[model samples]
Target: MTNEIYMTSKAWPFDQARAILRRLDIEKKRGIDRGDKPVVFETGYGPSGLPHIGTFGEVVRTTMVRNAFIALTEGKIATRLICVSDDMDGMRKVPGTVPNPDELEAYMQKPLTDVPDPFGTHDSFGNHMNARLRAFLDSFGFDYEFMSATELYRSGAYDEYLLRALNKFDDIMKVMLPTLGAERQATYSPFLPISPSTGRVLYVPMKAVNPEDGTITFDDEDGTEVTMSVTGGNVKFQWKPDFGMRWAALGVDFEMFGKDHQDNAPLYSRICKILGGNPPVQFVYELFLDEKGEKISKTKGNGISVEDWLKYAPPESLSLFNFAKPRAAKKLYFDVIPKTVDEYYQHLDGWSRQDEKQRANNPVWHIHNGTPPDENPPLTFALLLNLVSAANASDTETLWGFIKKYAPDATPENSPGLDRLTHYAVAYYEDFVKPNKAYRDPTDQERAALEDLVKRFRNVSAAESNDGEALQTMIFSVGKDHEFENLRDWFKAIYEVCLGQSQGPRFGSFVAIYGPEETADLIETSLAGNLS
Candidate 1:
């Protein structure tokens, strides 16, 4: 932490963005005063399974910090954002998310880069995963340079670092042993040698290390001593030292990982310092869980895939999901889609209304990489969903009619953004909302109140009706008149009994988008116990 972080009294955006910038500024200044080392930001990817939302979240969140750093630095400093893939890691087990689990059993404990691609597309399983990870990040237009651990180690990119670790094996063991069980502590080795016998990397205990000759002599499973040079692709590291070694070797300035790694990240920081290297500034975000708070993972295959989310909502909502207070674990489920979409619009709404200083605090500003997109599609996803139900719209043109009615400035030529959102809204409604929609029998009090509202709507022509805000006010007035004190229950009844959910968008905007006449028809249909 630096004093630049606490200078929010000066009206800077006081959040993760500012803190990231402040930390980078402190590091950059110290580095410059010393020798002007390049500031490097890194996010690691585990290519053990197919990429998911959590995979996207880390890079996206890091990019947010990178963007914030660049904004505060005004492009003054050189920065490198690196995405490293641990493809060299062994395929310990076949991930449930992947195809043909049984086939991978033969390759268990072999380096991932050597395991055959079950999909038969890429040369190896690790290569397939690496390609998929790249495609995933590229889909979101993430600005990052990709590095392969397989290439790095096999080609001697990490040879110098590998030798350093070999020479300091005892020191690495000192840093790593306390956390291990007594059995593990007795056998722990900082380096795993590629076994000459089984032709797979072995975690067997080292009998001796020749730093002078760059060879590690380790005992095989049969207690046969085998000596292999640490150079070439013969050696890779266990994770704790691997992390520290990479940071020291690559000059990583900052990085972030999950809270589950909370205990482990610091151990790497310590090992890095022991290796005569400074640790990267670290941030630990909470882990991702399903809607039920169950842990999300590749083996479980329990959480939403990146494809399903982008199919249902705009990609910007994903950014908004990442931009929230990262320390808090959020539910990354389909249920969160509507709220995130609406919140993105809310930030856009604030950006238009707030002055330049305050707009910097807006999440959309950071999400868009400091240039907020033009305020278009001025409707929320929840409201659009309600409109889909209100008009019973099956396609875009019908929805466009309502959009054009609400915003006369919208035209087919200019409203491509709205067109895309309309398509997403219709698909989301049909897939997630419509099938679950059931007609709830209206209560007697509710029936009478809705009956009165219908009568009022019957008298008011579509052209002469009050706008969304007025229509919203009048509906709430019916609830208040009937003494339904809980506005939440009132809205729940309106949405569930009418729209077939416990909630929808703001009623005023929903009514405005669907028009008062259509809303009346919807109310009348629900009141009459018809879900047509």
Candidate 2:
């Protein structure tokens, strides 16, 4: 009953959520009644490299859509979300993260499941990568079933599908051949025979397939011909065909992939159709890029690592980053983290004040998996950044002491949200802020602007400064007058010229929380070349 009330109360027809629910409804009617099965949602991970931010983005976004479907169905729907690791895949190249690259040359083209663990921890490289992937997602509290292709094929879970693909070899080949280059077309086959001689997965063109006996003949790297059974870990479908086969056998109803796979969409769909399965309702999101605008990669490691970001920011902020305009390619680097954290705080503030029905579009609602927090964090990330310096606080107690002075009503017990930010702010200050605190002699125009802005701030009555909204407005107006292009730079100057870094908390909130009198002194210090 509670679920129904929650579902019916929110605005339906939310862009992504509505689209997901609509497609899920169609799948239930078509696949369950007509096609005869439960709906499945699957996301694949290539365990060839250590998992990175992109890996998490896929799982988080897909789970979000799955959660929305579950909400709209009000527990009446039965669906499963699975994260499948392609641990059976062969390693084409060694990942940059792994050690002894030259050592792995010997293992090239070997199934990842067969390669030795480079770290000497897990049974194989695949298991090591899979363990890290699972641990990372578990840290974020995702609910998912983990499937290993190594186990799936070795245990014969994919045996029936493998044999069927072999039997229908000609049909699968017809769907795959046109996509290959002329050179590839001549040797193209839908199956890679796992060599019994070298115990390696051979990608060489299949010489023949004895469908009646379910054996595949292929040339080994040494120019020797080998025939192997299509079942029992002896052979596997090539990736495109393998993807479609998973959907057919597993009953996948929905999937979301990155744009790098966009070119393969048509081919994948045709393969799924040829296999008598409908490709799930799909979305292709853009890739995550570094500040240089290059795609983030497991080997390149161009963007922030998962555990590193979690160290300074909340997981919810990372979730917000993923949720924010996912269709557009965005920088997934440290420079984006402060802004994402501030945005998370804004949503929390919005959620606390808005009427329940109005929060249908509030990100905090989605961030919390549709149930937003009952209270907002007392301090924003930007605000806490200021408190760290204003109070010269090296620890929580000292920070709380300053908070109580300006926000007299705040107490540790009542403001648990701020409590979390306090720790992050202090650490961030030491790591990112404190070391960079140096005096930047403002340009004549910048110096004039800073002086005038401080004058206005000093001239304001304590009562006016006490008004949070009014003080923030003054800060923005003065920022533009000083030649800052945007509020971002406005704060950047405030931190760089005044606090000695490129960022800090929301200026107005920080001033209000830090007391207007202390803010005046901080500004004076900046103008006097004493920011250090």
Top candidate (TM-score): 1
Per residue, candidate 2 scores C-alpha lDDT tens digits across 17-107 of 4565566567567754544344577899998866777888888888777666666566566778899998888888887667777777788
Of candidate 1, the 10-residue stretch with the lowest lDDT total is 5-14
Per-prediction CA RMSD (Å): 2.9, 3.8
Rate residue 469 of model 2 by lDDT.
79
lDDT of each: 0.80, 0.77
Off by over 4 Å in 2: 1-36, 99-104, 353-357, 389-392, 434-438, 442-465, 469-496, 501-506
Error of 1 at 248 (Å): 0.7
Candidate 1 lDDT over 1-532, as tens digits, reads 3233323423222344455565556756776352555568899988987777788888988887777666666666667889999988877878775678788888888889989888999999999999999998898899899999889899998898888877887888888998899999888888888777666778877889888889998787677878889878898889888899889888887888999889898889988877767788788898878988988876677888888999898899888888787888877888889888888977887787777666666788778876888765777787788888877888988988988778888876787777788889999988888887876877887788778877776676565463776777777887888888787787788877788777776787777777677778889878777784
TM-score of 1: 0.92
Q: Report clash pairs, candidate 1.
A: none
Question: Model 1: residues >4 Å from true position, as ranges?
Answer: 1-36, 96-103, 221-223, 461-466
Q: What TM-score, over all chains together, does every model reach?
A: 0.92, 0.87
